[model samples]
Target: MIFTTKWYETVEPAGCKQRQSIVKALGLALGLLFSGHALSQNLVTNPGFENGASGWNTSGTTSAQIIESSGRSGNRLTHWSADSSYTVSTYQTITGLTPGTYRLSAYTIGGNTDDATLFASNCGNQNSQTAIPAAAWGNWTQVVLDNIQVTGSSCTIGIYTQNSDWTSIDDVNFELQSPPPGSGNDTAVEILAGKGFNYARIRLLVTPPDSYALHQDLDYVIAMAKEAKANNMNILLDIFYSNWWADPGQNWAPAEWFNQDVNTLENTVYNYTRDVLNQMAAEGVLPNMVQIGNEVNPGMLWNLGNISDNGWGNFVRFTNSGYDAVKSVSNNIPVIIHYAGVGSSATSWYASYTNNGGKMDAIGLSFYEMWHGTINDATTTISSLHSYFNVPVYMVETAAYWTSSDAGSTTSYPQTKQGQYDYLFDLTNAVKNINGFAGLFYWGATWTQSNNWLNAPDWQDDDAATRSLFDSNAQVNPAASAIVDAGGLSIRGVDISEAHYIESNGVEYLDN
Candidate 1:
């Protein structure tokens, strides 16, 4: 399979038709180059400068010409040289854009001068700017001006150089940054954060170097963490204990851990957890909450930690090892034990693990309406867990569909745009009504790109076509408003109340 993970592809019958549509859509889109990227249109004309600034206007001794093979990407790049006696610049005016946010980006390989700047501006005060910091020549540097709001119907994007030697730019991109029409006007993170959401969840894996979005790697995770922090949101780092997806059906170990004994495996888990956290901390993007293993209801590390085979002893040992490792790096960060199940399955697993001395600060649950039943079911189960175990519960992963197909309307919900909104509104309200339920994280919120996985040997799962908050065009769904409107207060700190629970005559009890 070209794609490494398909956890979102429901094995249930309802998902079969949806997956088929996704596969068909992907095949058609790939044949044209890309199928799902929202940036299908590069609004800038002659953006690569292969046409030698034909679409751009110049000023003041500024000469713009294309040099073949000089671009960091593509075949040609635009080279700019200034006489240094006055300001020299080049610009292109873009029209017919609706009022919303947009981004302008370009790559430059030379220009050690500090007087260079990139800008997006036009009538009615829509001006965004980015200063290219001083750096070495010959090494390509990316310059971007993001979050530039357009109040008018059009804008002009360009680069200005004053008293600078030379700078070659390529792959200039300027496009609508807002989600496609009907999706919403704001980013999912921005919308949710405005609604008082205090944290964002990011999952990481160790293998498949080129997973879509490079989500499994540390660099991507850290970058996401930085963005979350900038949004005033905390982070939940979910470490999937596998080179690929680690779920109930399969929990394959990383290549380095293969052939290792129980003791060695334990050490590996401990050290890996500690080092990952340490790196995150070093980058100043440490998570407030970390899940040692994702959906570890079946246990982790395969047979050794498999609850069905080795029982709770081995599972608890592995859990505690990870817990201790997390503490060794950052003592204050809360560790969570995530699992998939509700009702007796949830209660039974917790009972066994806690009895065997498994240590976790919180409990994370993956609750999907298709698999976990109704809203009432989730609230009731969460309430029961909190009442019994006295720990905070988070719906770490959940998503509902807007339309059943890429363009068709048919779904478990209303299948209309509003139906999508209502589902999330109801889900958020239900989670908030539960005392111990903190918040919910919609899975695959920004997976709107296509890749080789969409080709033959298809896994038949493309989230951008279904559960993602964005549509195939990368527009935010109306359902995103539910999160935008939900004023979630941060409750991520230590729950002192949980520590005060009591037990009498073998009956565990807690009074809030």
Candidate 2:
């Protein structure tokens, strides 16, 4: 539910200056059947412009020309005007496509003062354009235009720079991208399961504001639980306890429950949790583990459960209500208290919760290198938490970027496939070495460059596209191997059925 933005400066045809943030829309145009088969051939002729634009058409006030010794591979196409501002375009029309979705990609580097886009137009659906960041100069950055549905037989693919100082493009490629594989059709998830991914962590929202992207309703959760069970994977249901996103910065109560007093709100929380679990149980898809609330380090349900304003007493009361509900339905389901990030703040958050008599069977933490400290720091924090709390520790969420295009900040990893693999491998080893470490889950393992949801004009672009286990092509990347090898054979020694239990009518626990 984290969002990031990349802005682009565009010049309108009416001589108007406009600045817009890239907001990617979720889902594709309906009724367009995309085959799962991908075409490996690069459809663009003279893709690198090494042959001096043999198959390209250059147009505009300042014509784009091919230059040697500047291409990402051999020769790059560049456009610039020192005398005055001008527009230029280097393009090619691809015909006789297979009538499916296509992906256009290219490496670009140029000055920040100009507006440039790698675009695809005249296809079946609406035109798609990916802005080239102004700061991408001096370094080759790959930009992609995905989900180009080709209902016809042709599409225009090119790079256009308008009213600019200088821009350069190289190694342009246009190829067909396979559609998302259906359940049991996703080779990547199957591979992860084969490699040792026993649990699938799914987040549920009460009623997501954006149903297309943030949709995690009860039906959705039940369906996912059924899929995980079918795949022989355990389920970790993460309840956000809010209508929309619930993170450290914002955990607003659902609109209906926002006005309730403390006692009323506590009862509401218990009833809601019990209802959700009861439904899941009826469908024979009850989760193996349930988190009371996601990343509640800042507390949930706003003023009623916001520890900062109302203190831990109210927060603990709400949390215990949720814990009680989970136990009411099934004693086998272990309750996890999830906290975001790791450091002194995390330690203090847990300490305060435990001191307030909060109930939890496991400690779950979210670790991202850019937000949290180093991997070693995470390991140290994990060991400390386990030692003090006497509960199993789980790396409930973690990921590394396989590309630098959307990576906001720099890290020790190289932002390559291998770098992603290495980061995960080392972190898994570090945590596994700890005696109380339970397991790990790679967040967004199946997220791809296509179907970007966080792209509404009000929201920022989805920057986590490159952090997925799959590449833009929807193929499993090398980083997935690290996850498969790290915990493929190890099993934690906690039994959901016998380790803990609670009376059906009360919150008191009977420890095994």
Candidate 3:
């Protein structure tokens, strides 16, 4: 995580020459470091405008000028015309560089008029820009334009503003970034593990039609399970038992099983579940917990097992078949019955299934704040479910946005990085407070717009982007720290039956 900035200028800018010399002397005397790198130098000249706007180009009706006592460092550059509206740009062009990816960053604040951007262009790719939203008018926010492919040996980096209010920029930086290690998948899992997540939850679809979008087939899931094992994490395998996305409303049977009668469909479910687990076990990646049918509040396998249409008897039969299959694979793997939300309806749904002789080792709930109730509601429901069923309860899926975009209903949180962090911190604490709450999982932690399988509307789509814990560049967001901190807290009612069994048997669990 070290950054090295290469300063191209040996001479200080005009007005602040003496001050710059003093600062440099102090830095050398104290053995100061830049971005944690002792030898790192800034590639942008007069990055802080301490040199009186030297080594910079300005265009438009009003020229950008250096302003005193208003910078993130010593001084800053500002584009403001109080008398009239104007468009301006303060840019610096760096040339004669090695051809590779580079990152440009700057600290900026104040833009209430029109939109503005911190941008990089002509670096051997399409122009890259990070917009400074109109609401970013007071607090200083770090804006970065990364992954700038410098193919032509040069790139233009700067801020372009079309505003009547005002804008301030400081500490501009342009640095060459080394290529990342892998496809970013392994790094993402590692990041989650480092942040205190002990289990990796993956959804598996049976006989998916498309290989990309609905790609979590048996082989794909086995590969993912191996990855999780390699990362020293337990796996929670959620079997959808359908050919495509399966949720409360759309739990259709797979195409192959669509026409089967109720009795045959039950056997098919058992066989499919057993075969999936067998494959994973053969690969040495058997899941620590197996979820039979995801978010099946309405029942799984469609009409054949639909509780309303076919009665609780058929639904219970289908569910028990899957549960029996899990036991057949290994009695050690706990079985979880997943439901979509919290409340009386969900409680009654589970009650009916269990009353009809359905079996499960745990209860899983998808608790999204917008769709489900508040944190208080979740805590109450989790406690009730655990008490009623005498089984462990897990918040198997939850998420909050780090950016204000169209993901779903509005949340009490501000939809910013800090807002997301606060929400998760509060939610985690609430879950921990409830006795017997198994654990919590942040759903889609590694999802991003670039995930081809997601079929994002466009590059600008926020459906997945807003809620993902990682940004488009694969960088971990601030909310990850919340998860790390949450892991440190103790849950009062965690079930350690499996752990106890492992210890009592003298099993040597080796870290992969």
- lDDT leader: 2
Q: TM-score for all predictions?
A: 0.58, 0.60, 0.59
Better of 1 and 2 by TM-score: 2
Where in model 1 is the C-alpha error above 4 Å?
Answer: 1-196, 212-214, 405-412, 449-456, 484-512
C-alpha lDDT values of all predictions: 0.62, 0.69, 0.67
**Which lDDT tens digits does candidate 2 get at residues 224-306?**
55555665778888888999778899898989789999999999999999999988887777888999998898899997899
Model 2, residue pairs in steric clash: 24-455
Clashing pairs in 1: 180-475, 183-476
Instruction: Judging by lDDT, tell me the better candidate of 1 and 3.
Output: 3
Which is better, 2 or 3, measured by lDDT? Answer: 2
| lDDT string, candidate 1, 259-330, tens digits | 787888888889888888988887778888889888898888787888788777776777788899999987
TM-score of 3: 0.59
Q: Positional deviation of 474 in candidate 2, in angstroms?
A: 1.3
Query: Candidate 1's C-alpha lDDT?
Result: 0.62
